[model samples]
Every structure is written in C-alpha cells, then in structure tokens.
Target: MGYSRGIGIVGLGVISRAYLETLVGHADVRIVAVADLDAERARAVAETVPGARALSVSELLADPEVDTVLNLTIPAAHAEIAHGAISHGKNVYGEKPLTAVLDDARAVMASAAAAWVHVGCAPDTVLGTGVQTARAAIDAGHIGRPIAATAAFFSAGHESWHPNPHFYYLPGGGPLFDMGPYYLSALVHMLGPIVTVQGAGSRTRSVRTIGSGPREGETLDVEVATHVTGVLTHASGALSTVTFSFDAHASEAKPIEVHGEAGSLSVPDPNYFDGDVRISRGDGWELVPVSAGYEHGSRGVGLLDFAVGDAPARRASGELALHTLEVMTLLLESAETGERRRVSTAPERPEPVPLTTEAEWRRIADA
Candidate 1:
C-alpha cells in the first residue's frame, strides 16, 4: 500500500513558502511537522501551521504520523534529505533537478525501490493546464506527429534576485540545472524520452554580483557554464534544440515550440502552472483553449497526485525527475566532451491530466 497523506517538510528556504501555502489547508493530507537546518526558520513556519510542529530533521523523518517528506532543500542536499526520508519509511516529494549529482540520484532511486516508498519531484507545472492542454493537443494529433521543437530558457542570472545565489554558479547550478527541469520535463512529456544529446556551453563571466535580498553587491565565483545549447533526439525520432542561458540578457523566442507535419505549437512557460498555449497553422499562432489538466493549479500540485490520487501512474514520479536530471547532466557531459552522449534513463511520459476546473482540482492539488 502507498504511504499515508501525512507530510513532513525538510528545508525551509525561499521555495518552502509556496509548498507551505499550497499544502497547509488541504483536506486529504496533514502537515505533521517541518524541519530545517535553521531551527528558527522551521519554528517560525511551524507556528503558522496549526498542529504542525518544528522538529529536528531526524525527528521529523522518524515521526510515525508523517508518511511523506516534502524536501525543499538545496540541490546538494536533495539526495541526503530524500534518503533520510525513505530510511524512515516515508515517501518523498522534492523540488527540481532531483539531485546535484547523477550518481547520488541513482542511489536514491535504488533506495526507494528497496524500501518500497514512492518518490515524487517538482516542475509539476507541466501537469497544469497550459502544458497539459498543449500535450493533449499533440496527443490528439493537433500537431500531427511532432517532428521537432525548440525550448529556450534565458535569464540574466539569478544572483541579483535570489538571496543566496552562490549555488547558481557551482558545478551543478547553472541555467540548465536551475531552469532546465521545467523545459526538459515538458519536452519529455510532449516529445517522449530523449535518447541522444549533443551540446556546447560557454560562460560570460567568472564572477557574478548579487542583485537582491540581504546580500546585494556580493560577488561569487562562477564554476559552471552560464550558457548551454543542445540538441536532443527523442525516442520517437523528434529532435529538439535547446538553449538555456544565464548570460543572455533576453530573448524573443517563445518558451517552447513544437513543429509537426501538420502544424506547430507554442507552449507556455513550463515553470508556471497556467498560461496561453498557442497553435499555428498557415494563418498564425492561435490560442489553444484549456483543454486538459488541473485548472488554476499552483506549486505542489504534482505532490497532490502522489499523495491521494489513484491513476495509472504518478505523473510527477521521481523516475521522470531522474530522467530529466540525467538528460541535463548528459547535456553538460556532451558539451564538455564535444561528443554526442546517450542518456541512460528512459522514463515514461506521464499520463495526461484530465480537464478539471479550479473549483475542483484546487481542493486536492494541495493534497
């Protein structure tokens, strides 16, 4: 049997606010406790959640009332936190990238299997209306046999905005690692699993200055490529060109586009739950109405599917996140080696989300 809907959160950072807001009031799930490296932060957040306590990380993981651990830790700590959760017989739902390294993530998957616990990860935004509608269109043959695509994620760097942006420049932290999950996860769903990848990367500066939060003007060394461009060959024979960049000032490109023999599709930002998904015939790009997925969805919506929903599959399963991670890691490998790299993981595209209204799915998207 699957774990209960009781939840314990680990790592109370910036992203924790969104998860807390989304999960706190849900009926099917209970927020049993929250733990963070910072005890004060955990205590403060727990104070706001009725019946939720601030516990040490170990205590929260071992709490029998908690069936799942919502891991909101940094990339480096993802694997460790998740392993801890599974060790205590808890399911785990986490923020994106899965882990900072590929091998560590693999071990997490292995551990989950051995422990018989479920693992789910984020960018559940893909399960939202925009991407799902677009996906439904593709599956419905609105874009006949998707042949190609372009996914672009461009940013000037999060250093200026994120409180502690140092991680964004590290080996596992660039635009591809930070923002690529949404694009890659959406692409995998729309185009199927990526089999081969070739990429090239570059960095514009060695150090970046912090732009916002408490530590403005602080400079951190940049260790990873700031700009990454790649070509992914999906198992279905579709090819996708991707450009993920922190060096870019801006872009005119749509977030993602899919071209098929019959027509083309413009997908909304995969990072967000809702937007306008447009399709283009010979005439021009036309808005595709919300045809599928949870209406008015938000963060942690994917975790809801994991908690209480019974479907053919968990749409936001950790396996998919692992595949997304493997793809990104291989993209970097390909870039560094100047050789086409074959991805080792091949996660199935999640089942499509049925069209449901905000009034309906919202009640449980938080579950």
Candidate 2:
C-alpha cells in the first residue's frame, strides 16, 4: 500500500492529544483534519498540526483528503459516528468496546463490509510490547499449555478525576464497558477466544462523589455496575477469572496473568504499551526487559502503521470490534441473567509477531 498522508480525527477529547503527539514526529502519518461536537475542541487540536483544518463531522467525512475517520467520541456516540463515517466512504478507527450495543456493533460491521472500508478499534495497546512479548513467549511454549488465567481492573472511581463523570455510570460507560476492553483484549490475545462465561456483578454503592476535579463533591446517580467478576472458558480450554471494579481500593499491579501447566506469564497494565512482563519459571518470576520503540499516542500507532502500508487492509477490522463487544455483552448478560453466558464469536488471533528486532523494539519501547 502507498503511504497515507494522514487520517481525520472526530471527537477531540482527552485521548486525541496522545494520538496527535505521536503522529507529529512520524514520517508515515499525520492528522489532516479534526472534528468534534465542540467546535473549540476541534480548533484547538487543528492548531497543533500544519494545514490541518477543523470541520464538522459531516465535513470531515466528506473531505476528499480524509482517508480515515478516527472516531474518539464517547461510548454512546461510537456506533453513530462510525455509521456516518462508513456511509461517507471513509474507514473508521474507533475507541474500545466498539459500540454500546451488540446489535449496533453488528450493523456497523455489516455497513463497513458493504462499503468496503475498514473499521479498527482501540486498545490496540494489545499490539504493544507488553502483549506482543507475552504472545511470543506463549507461542514458543515458554509457559507450556495454557490452563487458567486471571485479570483484574480496579479504580477508586472515575468521579474523582473525570471532568464529567456522569457518563461513566451509564449503561455503556460502566467499569465493565469502560476498562473491560483492555483486559478482555489482552486475555483474548494470550488465551485465544472464550467459548463460555459465567459472571456475578453489582454496584457496591448507590451514589459516588468525585474525589477531585471540578465535579468533586458532586453526586453521581449509579445506573450500571461498579464491580464485576467472571469466569471465561477459552477455546484452548483455558479458564480465566476476570474482574472489573470501580469501587475497590488497592495497590497498583499489572491487570492480567495467564497461567500454563508449567508456569505463569504476568502481563503489564494494558492501558499503556511497554510495561514490565515477567514469566514465573521454577521458584520465582523473572522480569523480562522490554525492547525499545518510539512511544507515540496509542490511537495513532495503528493509523501510522496503516499510513506506512506496513499492516493489512482492515488491519484494525470491525470483526475484532464485534468480538470485544460480544465478550463484554456476555459478561453483563451473565451478571443479569444469573446464568452462564456463552460467547459464540471470538476475535481471530494473527500469527505471533516477535519482538526480537532491536531497532523496531526500541522504537516501540522508547515510545
């Protein structure tokens, strides 16, 4: 593929900054335009990039120069934004959980397919060193046959820091939907797809107060779960205990671990790329030194790979989006139905990509 000049970004929220910073110095990519419901936010982002214009969502989608639409809208707007982009013949790059609803996610996937445009989802953090390294070790049989795994995501609560914390408590924005993608994506990467799931979840508190930020001391009406715990049975016969929580207080550690018959692999926190990875061999776990690489904002890396023609078409395809949505939906379904939920669909695992190349690894590690 030829190099893409850049992609247009929609929704200039907190995450867009990271993508911009990462794209600025890269030869393969650029941000050619920006759009947000908030015009000021779009203009602010446009100011940072050369010749980049701030446009409305319609204008961004219609522009001939915009090859892909980066959909960073909130959870509620994800599917609609993606639908609009696909309708206008632009590929889409979306934030995690794909869409708030499973059926809508399927519709978006179908639309993208008919349009022949790609749709990629975020938490492409899985492509980073942390996940890649673990995948490589597992493929090399370093951990032996996978048997069981555990993943935990915990936060005091988002009300503490998010300027607008109300959305977080809504149906599409709880701990399971918000933070579950990173953990689920990592688990799928390491253990393959889950065939069955059983879960129990609840909101520990009826209302939460922001710990800090402008919203501090404000009360938020809780609509969805604050805590969730589930068991995932993978196609490979690995069973994983997964937990997501907004109510817990605990010391920070990596969010996931995959145990094999022989040993265990501890994954780095999935929120960022290039954290420490360790393998338990014999008596103790040994920290694996990360390879180096340029640390660009997370959103831009996949687009950068696309711009450089280094990745496949639909490289961040909608199918992965569907799979993630299915997993999350099942988790919630299991919690509500009081029965084990089976995930019929699973994300395809590409062949293991090694992290042995010093220069490439350094580029990712350093980044």
**Per-candidate RMSD, Å:** 2.0, 3.1
Worst 10 residues of 2 by lDDT: 358-367
CA lDDT of every candidate:
0.89, 0.77
lDDT per residue as tens, model 1, 1-367: 2343789999998888888777787766779899988999889999999889999999999999999899988898999999999998889999988999999999999999999988999989999898999999999998799999999988899986789988888866999999999999999988899999999999889989998888998899999999999999999999999999998787899999999999999999999989999988878888898999888888888888888787455899899999989999999988899999998898877888999787675564332
Best by TM-score: 1
Compared to the true structure, candidate 1 yields what TM-score? 0.97
- Taking the tens digit of each residue's C-alpha lDDT, what string does model 2 give over 211-317? 77776788988989889999988899999898889988885655888889888999888777667789997789998665422232255665554445444533345
Clash count, candidate 2:
16
Give the lDDT of residue 41 in candidate 2.
Answer: 80
Q: Each prediction's TM-score against the native?
A: 0.97, 0.91
